[model samples]
Target: MAKLLGLDKVATFFRIIRGNGGIFGSVKTLFRTDELKIGNLIGEDKYGNRYYENNAYFVGRNRWVIYADKVGLNYDGSQVPAEWFGWLHYKTDLPPNKDPSRPKYKWMLDHEQNMSGTNQAYMPYSTTRPKIESWQPPQ
Candidate 1:
């Protein structure tokens, strides 16, 4: 009777929710990421970004990342490091940790998220006179 009435579809929905983590956990994840997804944990980068992959999902949309809570809602694509950037965008089949050929040199710098709006962002100090300066009225 459940199948006849199509209530079976609802069961699958509940299963997905349960897989995400029961009702409360599911709701929390939904609010945090704006969507509920079930997938295998691909790997996590040094910045604490978590990568996920579910072939069940459509091609481009199958891969995703959940930024670490330390940054709260300030996270953005710029936070994704160059290495993970390639994997996240499907430029490579293997993740950084699993990619044996990835280079690591002594001069390599650590991951630092973009700071365009923050105090750490780059600020230029120019000694040269401006090509166009504001005109001053008789003082």
Candidate 2:
């Protein structure tokens, strides 16, 4: 009966608002990620990204990460380091911090996000000359 009368949606709206800690929280969340949700904070990475989980939500959808404020709206999945990536993808139930078996070695390099499309992207040096000649602009 509630579903037929559209009361379910109304209830959900209020529930979301309440979960976010009332009106102000809802607005803050809206500006931040545009989604209102309630969940327990699972962990935080060194990059300042925060991970959250809520069993009430569907399995995959229940877990998520909020990127660091420094990334602003430019945040991408690449920014998630390997340690956190494993948890995010359900590779392991325990987070990096909780997993004592994980190995750390002096030879291991620190994680870095792919920079293929940005100004820092790698450029190769060419040793051979081009077959085609370029036209020079008039000075």
Give the winner by TM-score.
Answer: 1
Give the range of the ten consecutive residues with the poorest summed lDDT in model 1.
68-77
Q: Model 1: per-residue lDDT, tens digit, 1-139?
A: 9999999988878977988789997887788889988888999988788999999899999999988879887778888999889998989989998989999999999887788988999999999999999999998
Clash pairs of candidate 2?
none
Query: What do the candidate models score in CA lDDT, each in turn?
Result: 0.88, 0.88
Q: What's the C-alpha lDDT at position 47 in model 1?
A: 76
Q: Model 1 reaches what TM-score against the true structure? A: 0.84
Kindly report which residue pairs in candidate 1 clash with one another: none
- Model 2 agreement with the true structure over 58-77: per-residue lDDT tens digits: 99988889888798888889
Clashes of each: 0, 0
